[model samples]
Target: MKKESKTDWPRINAMRDEDIDLSESPELNETFFKDAVVWPAQKKQITLRLDPDVLDFFKSQGKGYQTAINKVLRRYVEAQKHH
Candidate 1:
């Protein structure tokens, strides 16, 4: 028996042949580097307690669970910064 894997997102592959309109789109060349790269994270790691139910909820999303959690945390941080 073997586990199943998900198919890759076609848009990403299709991006290779995409006829991007650089003049119309502001974000096309927004990044500093032209090459594909992972953006840097502004926050540092710290251990914190979370309810079992909350952890289970994000884990069920299958992938990018940590990214979801970080997004929530980042929203909170951004709100606090403006106060």
Candidate 2:
């Protein structure tokens, strides 16, 4: 038997709120968001040098390449903190 994927967005959106099922969903409360950290939207400007290949790779991904690079660097910093 083939397994069904859960990408049925149209059908899901058409559902009435009362007809929707939420038995498997976890309850969210104030405690769930108490410790959440909010990041500042402001960005700092700095000059940095990168190898030609590295810069080219991100540039090929089209717009928002700089943001993508920042995200990768952020993940690296977060991982290093756990050590």
Candidate 1 Cα misplacement greater than 4 A, ranges: 1-24, 27-47
Question: Candidate 2 — which pairs collide?
Answer: none
Q: What is the TM-score of candidate 1?
A: 0.48
lDDT of each: 0.75, 0.87
Tell me the alpha-carbon RMSD of every candidate. 7.9, 9.1
Expressed as tens digits, the lDDT of each residue in 1-83 for candidate 1 is 28665756575567654565567544655463554445566767789789999999999998999889988986798689878
Residue-wise lDDT of candidate 2 within 1-83, one digit each (tens)? 29777779799889999888889775677875774556868899999899999999999999999999998997798789976
* Ten contiguous residues minimizing lDDT sum, candidate 1: 30-39
Which candidate ranks first by TM-score, i.e. highest?
A: 2
